[model samples]
Target: MFSKIRKAYQLFKSIDFEQLDKLSRKVDLPKVMDSFSKLDEKQLNGLMKMLEGGKPKRELPPINGDFYELHLRLSEEDRALQLKVRDFMEREIRPLVNHYWLRDEFPFEIIPKLAQLNICGLTYEGYGCAGRSSLMEGIIAMEIARVDASVATFFGVQSGLAMGSIYLCGSDAQKQEWLPAMQQMKLIGAFGLTEPEVGSGAAGGLTVTARKTEKGWVLNGQKKWIGNATFADVTVIWAKDVDDGEVKGFLVRKGTPGFEVEKIKGKMALRIVQNGLITLTDCTVDESDRLQHAHSFKDTAKVLQLTRAGVAWMAVGCARGAYENALDYTRKRKQFGKPIASFQLIQNHLVEMLSNLTAMQTLVYRLSELQDADMLRDEHASLAKVFCTLRTRDIVSQAREVMGGNGILLEYDVARFLADAEAIYSYEGTKEINSLIVGRSITGFSAFV
Candidate 1:
């Protein structure tokens, strides 16, 4: 006991007097010393070792998809807006996505919350829009999709496809009538372009025909896989004019005579997005309701080009969400009495996922830069769409791979991303179509026909 007291006294003498003084305020130092003096030799040695701190634990870097730090390149204001959208998504969207996704329904209550962000029509000028650069729009899209791709799809339909059609191809009257309401999300919108029979052949072969008459123009045909159409207030319908054989755009309002919409069911992926099969049996749209400037397929392509770029950005978000969730899961999940993330095989999968995700992020950033510079062409958008979406598919699949059986379980989130990636893969443009667009641009050959 005397030896223990001597050792404890000597140990305390070595501690910094300043630290001891600070500790006296919080603890009864005299009582501590008295207790320490009564300890056995083994206890004294343990106390001595604790006083001399052991080896420091190393801090590892966080897991992030933006390995190249592309988000840092955004201007201060743009970065703030990006973070705001990310916060909204993470807070409002993430918690309820799996529930809604499993039920195949949208959370309509979020529309007003989404409107508060003031991001709709972000790249367009005037009409209550932000009129920000396209890069900002891409970042916003990525952030929204990083939580739920179905919500992102609904937004893209409203902001990009529906509003972009009017912004790029509508007359002054049409813009004034629609852009503001849509920008506020007070009026949800959808785009009807892909027909049941005509998927990739929409450029020259639209079966939906519009016949001109003194009363109005009569449209007859069917449109399938129209996102948001089940609840959209308005849809931008593309039809071929039988008189001149030219493609024209029309703002077909809800409940129009002879226009019928049937909600599609049993979708394998992106089920939360309300896709509709629209039937126009002699539906009459006013002459003024037609997109005044959309005279041919070339005019329609303008809107597609704009939205396709946004789709590429959305693909990045889906891959990012998957990679991040899978990365986090690996860290917590243990195998063989250790974290699976520490395993060489698991680390290889993680590194491969990160490599693809980083590449996608950097490519989309440059793609948005080109768009903001007004130098973006069809091939440019198509290439990014092709690469990002293709890589996103692979990244999500690998994310599932690392997660083992839990990857398919919805609670883990990678499963949702994995399922949603299939929808992103086919929408806006398919891989084959986009690749051909790039191929034609590089080779100067018309392979699409």
Candidate 2:
């Protein structure tokens, strides 16, 4: 029995004895191990081939953040701009983003370099815009958020939401006057829509009131979560018209009488974004400042339509950032005498995260495609927004989980993503709000009250 045990040890060295014992019920281990031990070089090779037979080989393509080959689809000029922005983000933003996030402060120095990207108002035709495809614009948004979500939010407000208001709703003269300077980032813009008491319900519940007087329009109300409002040269404010009861938009230039902005502090997510609580006490603006094309809440919905798709792209970027960082960390982190990634349970978590991330990437790609074709509807963007943000929350959580105790540490990087994902989930639209948008479209019922 001692000799047999010694020989069995040699044969089953690579295979666990416990596993071999389990296999003994199916195959006589004594005979099998003896045969395995006696096999010469040629016979051993043949036996190995037979054991692996009939299993199809799966050669997976290399993992990449840009799953749909979007960079290759861009024109040379646009591709160059994309790379320039990516380079700027990697060099200027990546190094200091975590620092700012830790301190909950904005990095003012990087603004100049970011302004140099010439990507603001990317999809708008004329008015100093590159007039690129919406797909390219979406790609740039993804790239920006992939590095730093706060910066992306800053740019999105200045470029898409704020500038887009003027581009889509302002008069022809307003576009000519503001587009060039804003595009160059010489004139920064902020959007004021959500109020201190209203958020997702801004469509019908804006507390800000705009009363027309001999001087102009008097705006009296408060806005909350207005990004970049603290330092913006111009803030696009949406308020209810006193006479017509329709929601109207105004281009309230900075320093307007009765207009004030105060920074909102102690935010757990998107800390780098200087969100503001704006107050308007009889803030008067010239008649020309009123958005000529913005007749009602439906018009404001259009602006949201354009920006919501970009938010979905941002969600994809966030998940990708967390995934890449976690994957790299797992490969390098060792535990129990081997890489934690080599453990079965850890691998399962990783695969789950990757699966969700891949699904999000594909969904956003399709969403952007639909948007570029001008076939995108609210429900289309809403679906992607709901799906991606939900998945991003899950993916980032798993990312932190795999990091263990270091997951909660800001220096580890994944922790920032985990925290910031909460903002992404709430902003643009909450999970329930976005789902209701999609549900209304598919079921032909308006569930939002």
Candidate 3:
């Protein structure tokens, strides 16, 4: 007993007195030492264990899909902006997602906070836009969808489809009028392209008709699945020119005499996105409101081409959200007195999910690189869309599978991602449609016809 005390005393002496004094100023070191000095060998062990009980529990590293550390490749400025968007999504979007999705309601309350992020027109050059790289834009898209696909879809329509239309096809005067306010999100925007009878072939064939008049152009058509149309301040309505038999775009403002919008309801997926059925019965748009640079369907295709890569990134986000949630659940959920994550089968599912997720991340990283380099093509974006959305469906399925019955519950979050994946798979462009686009590129034959 004396020997043990001597050894403990020697160890105490080894700690410098000055260091101890400094520590004493911050903590009750003398009291702690006195308490330890009173303990016998077994008592010391017991006291040590008790002290440890007050210490923070060991925490596991967060589950992330970026196994290759793709985020590190971004420049410091870009990386900081990426984290800002991610923080916004986590803080603003995540909490409200399940609630809004369940009620089929849009959270108008989030708009001002969202605008504060200054990410609305992320990649545009002029106006109040960030004028960031395509890579940064893709990263932002992934971050948004990581929390909620519905929110991501709404954002994509506003920033990518709507704003991109103006940036790519609107004249200098038109851009000056809309881009600044839209960039600040003071003026919300929507893109109207797909009509009731015209969807996949919207590029060449649109049922929406546009007639020239001295006053302006008269637009008559029905647009279906037009996201954000119900409340958008400006909706870019695309119509076929009656005289030239070519597609043209018109900036149709809200409350236009013949413009009508009905909120599309009873949706099973992405319910938070306010899709609308817009009817234009002789909706007269001023000639000045027309997208002057938009001469043909080809001009409209440019806008879709720019935004399609973003859809692919959004798929990666959906899969990542589902995978991470499932992984967390498996680690905590016990079976046979052990965590399910310990089971070989559950680990297999995790590995598969991670593999698909990594593939998607790398693919989109390259896709955005191509975009930034101005070497991106329609087929490049389409391939990524086809691959990522397909893999996301599988990843979300595995996420659900690992969770057993709880996976289907909205509280689990995996169910929403799974349901949203179906919408992503079909929207923008279906698998078969995008596949044919790629097929034509490789074979040098127009298989789409």
The TM-scores, one per candidate, come to: 0.89, 0.84, 0.89
Error of 3 at 243 (Å): 0.4
In order, candidate lDDTs are 0.92, 0.87, 0.91
C-alpha RMSD of candidate 1: 7.1
| Candidates' RMSD to native | 7.1, 9.7, 8.0
Which candidate, 2 or 3, has the higher TM-score?
3
Model 2 misplaced regions, further than 4 Å: 1-63, 67-80
Scored against the true structure, residue 431 in model 3 reaches a CA lDDT of: 96
- Model 2 CA lDDT for position 49: 56
Show how many residue pairs clash in every candidate, following the order shown: 0, 0, 0
What are the clashing pairs of model 3?
none
Local accuracy of candidate 3 as per-residue lDDT tens digits, 1-449: 56446645655675697887887799886676666677788876555456557476668778877888999999999889888988998888888789999999999888888889989888898799878899998998899999999999999999999999999989999999999998878888999998788889887779999999988999997999999998999999999999999989999998999999999999999999999999999899999999998999999989999999999999999999999999999999999998999999999999999999999999999999999999999999999999999999999999999999999999989999999999999889889999999999999888776
Which digits, one per residue and each the tens of the lDDT, describe model 1 over residues 337-422?
Answer: 98898999999998998899898888888998998888999999999999999999999999999999988999999999999999
The ten-residue window of minimal lDDT in model 3 covers: 3-12
Better of 1 and 2 by TM-score: 1
Cα lDDT tens digits, model 2, 1-449, are 45444544654577776886788789986687666566566666565556668366655445465554656756898788778887888888999998898787888887777778878898999987988888888878888888878888999999999999999999999999898999988898999999888998988899999999999999999999999999999999999998999999999998898999999999989999999999999899999999999999999999999999999888888888888778778877999887798889888988888888878877877787888888999989988989999999999999999999999998778888888888988888888999999998889899988
Which candidate would rank higher by lDDT, 2 or 3?
A: 3
